[model samples]
Target: MSTESSAATTLTTADLTLVRALQREPRATWTRVGAVVGTDATTAARRWERLHKAGLAWLTAYVTPPTWTVGYVDLACTPDRLLAVGEEVCRWPPVFSVERTTSDHQLFLGIAARCYHAMDTLVTKRLGVIPGVRSVRMAVATHIHREGGGWTVGPDQHEPSRTSLPLPQFWQDGSVRTIVDALGTDGRLSSAELARRCGVGESVVRRVLARLLRNGELAFRCDLAHVAAGWPVIAGYRLDVPADVLDRVAAAVAALPETRLSAAVVGRGNLVVSTWLRNPADTTGYEARLLRTAPGVRVLDRAVTLTMPKRMGRLLDQAGRAVGYQQILPAGGHPVPGG
Candidate 1:
């Protein structure tokens, strides 16, 4: 484990290099990463281990259910039960993210479930029953133009490989679910280790992984604590964009330096965007520049995230350091009970 003093230090150039390498290849071998980053395999592995221990960096896998629907929900909560409600909602199996924001709605949730019926049940039956619940407004996502997996902390040292591979038609089998579960917490697991966990051969594991990556059925995200990374302010926005230029507007927003997430959903505010700002006051300037770049884009509502208790399955401290992880498996995929 890294000492508190060492963990408190700012990230070094070598640390950034290693993180960039992992961003390109989330599951690459240490030897391969070392070759690219100009270091020995042992040093590369040790540096990554340190980063993970400090809660500054981590890798997580996301599998999109084939027949599932995705939704972004806003909940209005009574002031007294806000904290309790947020904590409980984060434990739901289908919920991927939960945030406390400064807006009319106190909480924001991202959910994924098997189908429309499943999503309805989750919102109406499960989430609605929570004690502090007031009102729920959900926006079903139509297309995900950009996700956090594509966001990077630094520029790439080398161009990523563009090699194309054949994709599988069906990936909802038990073996695939096993692989996803094993890799969810640790995306750097070796093929042999994954095979052992899945009770399959190494070659079979490799094949399934390749298909998942090629077909866009899975996304691997390299997460960092924003405040620790020197970017303290996290802001979210919903944009009302012209229908014809929606895709163009989303692309422009994703290209911004501060963008952490950008997507198009079905709601009054169709485009949802999240950005990290160097300072809280920079929000106005950033929004101004966005309007200049995308002429017809109108900002509907903006909220600054006051506290994020959980993100991408990892529970975070007040200072944004990862303290532990909570595994939320897909409800309809495989029944791995949450701990």
Candidate 2:
């Protein structure tokens, strides 16, 4: 067996049960988590702390798309400086996820911005001018059928219910921003801790958090190293579809068990999908399954992720574990130093 698979086996079934319990309720109390996992609160908390400290699992939050403009960028960089270019871009707050992929466009980025104009400026003026960047192709997500935040740790979990809440004026409140930044780094922070960080009363923190969650303004997710989770391969597919069937195609693709992200975009390819697989060979079978399920989808391009340096502002190591954290504010709101 490969080293990754061997490392994966080290996670006991009990450890995964704890992860799944959190996947269902990201901010549940240790008492609650222990109840669901059939262990005591102290043991559950201790085990989670160990996994988190090792960068094997984590919890984080993000402002869901449609609240801000969501876009993807495919960048072709000089082969010699490809890793350098990815490192530079990954530090920016707007670029939430950066992947080194097996394609002519060596880097793929997921970006969020306040508006299309801001996204354009960030790309054309900021990203496009990077020293080693040879070319840029940006696609605006017209619909977010599924996103990484919606994915769960194991099989048999239903998709989280989604509620479309209007953007509230208080979204820009200082306390709210503080809460979001703190939770984005550690979603499991207690209300008292979050209140302390936001310099507000616990009651105030509770009220605001309830409002945000009830309104669907903030999203929390439980994430773990994919390799340790035993799904070692990530494949992305670009698809062309007639506009008439775009939504239908997106729904069909997003419903697949392996899908991590499925979105309709306004670009060369109208549909883009990313999926987890047991092995590289699964990519072929996945495409064939998509063809049978979503006949309207015509696969245009594909790329397999080689390394994910960052995801949703959390820096990851080669094994896809969260090694460091960066706050991802609304795209363009936080300025990068020296930009």
Candidate 3:
């Protein structure tokens, strides 16, 4: 088994490079990656085997944000209630992402839906009814930067900053079949995995990824569920409003406190809101606080999400644990000095 990268594990220079590449493009092929870091595919693959088994790096997929399909909220509570509340939050379909972080004051939520009424049901009827829930905070997604290309941390960054220019935009086409397949297994997959999945040489996978990197075609991985580790108080709410005023009203909803996410959807009764509360008893003036901020005088409808169906971002379970390669540090993994 490989070592774990924790506060205690020591990192090597090679390990740092691997980690850095993942930071650049979690999906880059090992073959391509080696080319950038001055090694062959086998060498890179060997290095990765150790790093992963050691728990130095992990690759995962995050449900992209800036979605217009859902609503969101935050909850606050004691650390002791996190697991209980998290289990409850994972029961609803609209609740996409649930986290236990954010100023230690709120439990973050990511909501999704086709309309507003469905969101309302999640916040008021389902969530609010929960015995432990205190209040719900709500918001809507107006603009988003889904895990599209551009966040990939590449080799040494010796290459010029690609951030200054517009990221290349391309829809997922069959050309990326190799790349995507690799990512399906490990967002932090080395080039060897990509080659094996695409039935190509490691070099080919590497080349393709380099191109994808410049084009901004890959999605960055994220683990939003980690926040649920902290205990929190969660709640859901809604606003009563006519359809015409949605744009103005929705904006108001996004700014509410303890709100981690929001969305507009069909069946979401009125305007839905989700918020985090430190305590259930602190839900004072929830209506006036949220609805009043909306641009129009609208009736609020809501239901607390008692049971969330699924949450965003699952940790990689298929990652290898047995180490086969020489022990070494991971790429892009070196710690920066001074905090």
Candidate 4:
């Protein structure tokens, strides 16, 4: 398996199996993976390194939403000073993800301290103070649901119709192992391919999938990459408003055009709103409008992003598995299905 070079790199079927197995139980030992994939432990470890180096896969521990304050900022830099500005923003202590998008604005952000104060401190004390920061629009995370990214696309598999939706752990019993893994990476897999991956016949897979859909173990028609619809404001905002209207304000902003991911997360202000503007020029006006839309609103902080080093809910790494340069670039729609 190769993660370093997407081109001229190849992965074995066993590597594919290993990828699926680890996604389920991050702690699955090499001995365990070897047994399931029919390889020795040493080979498994070496293969793990190969996968890591090639950037094909990663084993990660996620930051549960409760603990970290997720902030989004859109920053407009001097066109000539853009690269220097990106370098400076990337230096901020709290930023875990930074990336330059198609827009002139750079996306700079991170998952940080839970106290809303920390967000203000970062904005006023850290990010806002950066050279050429211009102005920023900030948003805090309230509740986050990063949709299952793995969905296969091809002849045999059609997106499985989960009859009943089940809890995340519903598959702890193994009735839908393949189904879950497939949807986890790519949510639009065909039933025929799903049955092949799960080692079951197509008919059985369909029946079980229908039940899972009905139970809620599976979600239908959820595309977290809301930017897919193609509007680009990258609106990030922070506001101090009555706590009671928190939900309503967030909902209203979310209802606007080009809302990809929105949250009422922890931050200095009571609410942090994330949305796309479709026009960076409208950035300030957009924030002012949010304040106007809701009564008694005060703008506390804001910044536009320069770059998104990591997006959605990607795991950066942990103590042992956290390799510095290793990143599982979300698949740009690969064959087996996975985010």
Specify the highest-TM-score model's number.
2
Name the TM-score of candidate 1.
0.88
- Report the lDDT tens digits of candidate 1 across residue range 292-323: 76787888889999877777677776556677
Model 4 segments more than 4 A misplaced: 1-169, 220-230, 313-339
Whole-model Cα lDDT of every candidate shown, in order: 0.75, 0.82, 0.47, 0.49
TM-score of 3: 0.45
Give the top-scoring candidate (lDDT). Answer: 2
RMSD of each: 3.8, 3.3, 12.8, 13.9
Candidate 4 lDDT trough over 10 residues, lowest sum: 329-338
lDDT at position 204, candidate 4? 76
Can you give the TM-score per candidate against the true fold?
A: 0.88, 0.93, 0.45, 0.46
Tell me the tens digit of each residue's lDDT in model 4 across 10-55: 4456766665555443445678877876889789778876766534
Better of 3 and 4 by lDDT: 4
Instruction: Give the alpha carbon lDDT tens digit for every residue of 26-82 in model 3.
Output: 556778888877899799878876665654444543223321243456665656776
The TM-score that candidate 2 achieves is 0.93
User: Residue 151 deviation, candidate 2, in Å?
Assistant: 1.3
Candidate 1: list runs displaced more than 4 Å: 1-9, 64-67, 155-169, 331-339
Give the worst 10-residue stretch by lDDT in candidate 2: 330-339
